[model samples]
Target: MTLTPNEILALPKVVLHDHLDGGLRPSTLIELAAEIGHELPSTDPDELARIFSDNADAGDLVRYLEAFAHTTAVMQSADNLRRIAREAVVDLAADGVIYAELRYAPEQHVAGGLTLQQVVEAVQDGIEDGVSEALEAGHAIRAAAILDAMRHLDRSLEIAQLALDNRGRCCVAFDIAGPELGFPPAHHREAFQLLRENHMPVTIHAGEADGAASVGEALGLGSARRIGHGVRIHEDIDGFGTDEVSYGVIAQHALDQQIPLECCPTSNVQTGAAPSIADHPMHELRDLGFAVTINTDNRLVSGVTMSSEFGVLVEAGWTKEDLFEATLAAAWGAFLPYDERADLAESVIEGYGIDL
Candidate 1:
């Protein structure tokens, strides 16, 4: 059965690819920008929200990423960072997200003279505050940080060290996020190697702006435990919709390994990664034995909540069982211990009211 919007909102969810800088509340954005005299496209919260959504709908990854400058501009201070991080958790919890991994580049937040370590600490403080407040409000949500390093920069090794130092404190994984073209994951092999030696989990943004080869580099070079926005893996398939489907070497490898794909359908459509929700490859990939998990890559920028994302999928022919399987896959793919993952799986199964 197709799930209604309210039912979708009540369903327990897990998000592994959310961006902290891209999910700020519109009112908070205006207020933070005002505090620092930063000019915005619109000062009114509603108008500002529309402006962000419209700007990000440019149908190109480079153009879509232009919206982040404004949000990151206002996030240069510890107070602002903490406030945004807290609100992100509270908002996700209100939307029924039981577990979320909010990611952002610490290097991007140091423009105001804060150290990378300071930025991580501030965000962690906010996450703790958000968790306590959400629990008090009758929502039980657990949030963790995934520190990202921009692929276009030269500080990935340093950022990887930062993530390592903050492990178990707040950071759970390290990632590289930026334009997937021109800059391949191999360029940051040193950083990835450092993370590997430290036994830290890594997720790479690939197969979104680029093609399946980029995904191959993420697995082979970066040793990514999860692929962010891997919708482009369809490029390696010979035929998609018929019994004649055949997977390429890379696609076959991913399927054989069951590596999780953090599929963000709305953001993918906006960035021209997918034509539309009706034609997204998430269901097909899942059917073909790939571990596909749904996520909100950027909530405010994409103008979506977890519930709205699932609602759109249901409209596009996904069933309630589809949501359950995807959510379960997300739990299994989370950067937690096996015992923790099992507990999360149990929570999801209980929430869905299904025997699995």
Candidate 2:
């Protein structure tokens, strides 16, 4: 049975791969851009939103990422960073996100002279503010930060330290983002080693612009607890949908470990990772016993919410049970303590009125 729109919206979601810089509200972008004298493709919110959505559908990873320039341009100041973070939480809560780990590269936001620590603090402050506002509004949401270091840059070790230093304050984990092709996770080995030594959770952005080799390196070398946009793990599977399917080394490793795949269907389609949502590997991966979870990689850039992402899956022939499984997997895969993950899983089961 397909879920009704209201049913979809009422389901609790846990988003682990959302980017703070990619989820800005169009109106907020307009206002912040004007304040910073940053020129945008369009000043009108509706028009600007259309431009971002359309441009990001370029079916190319690098082109899809270019939309962030405008969003990040306004996010340089502490106030702007806080506002964006606050709005992200408020928006997610309104969309029925019970828990979220919003991520952003601290190094990117240092353009306005804010130090890395200051950037983390600003985002954490904003998340706390947003959580308070959501609770007061009767939403009851919890949100935190994931500090990211651009993969192509040389500051992964420093960013790893930053995340470790702010472990409980707001930052929960560390990630390496940015263009993924030439700059594999190996380049950030030192940073990954540091985070590994400190026991900081990691989720590497692999198998998106690259392939299964990138994913293997993420797991084997980077010590990733989760794989970001890991849809391309399908590449390592021979005859993915057939009964005679065979798993390659990386695929076998991921399956053996039950590693969570942070699959973003809409963003993956937009980035040309999959031909379309119907053809996406998420459902098949789920059927394969992979830890598959649904996510909105970027709200504004991909023009998706948790509800809308599920809605698209429904349109593509997914049942409500599929949605429930994905949500439960997300709760289990959250970068939270075991008790907290259990709590989140319980919340999901309660929201769905079902038991796994």
**Candidate 2 residue 277 C-alpha distance from true site, Å:** 0.7
lDDT by residue for model 1 (176-261), tens: 99888999988899999999999999999999989999999998889998999998998899998677899998899888888999
| lDDT tens digits, residue span 159-223, model 2 | 99989999987788888998899999889888888888889999999988889999999999999
Each candidate structure's TM-score, on Cα atoms with residue i matched to residue i, is 0.98, 0.98
What residue runs in model 1 are displaced by over 4 Å at the alpha carbon?
60-63
Question: What 10-residue stretch in candidate 1 is worst by lDDT?
Answer: 58-67
- lDDT of every predicted structure (CA atoms): 0.92, 0.90
Best by lDDT: 1
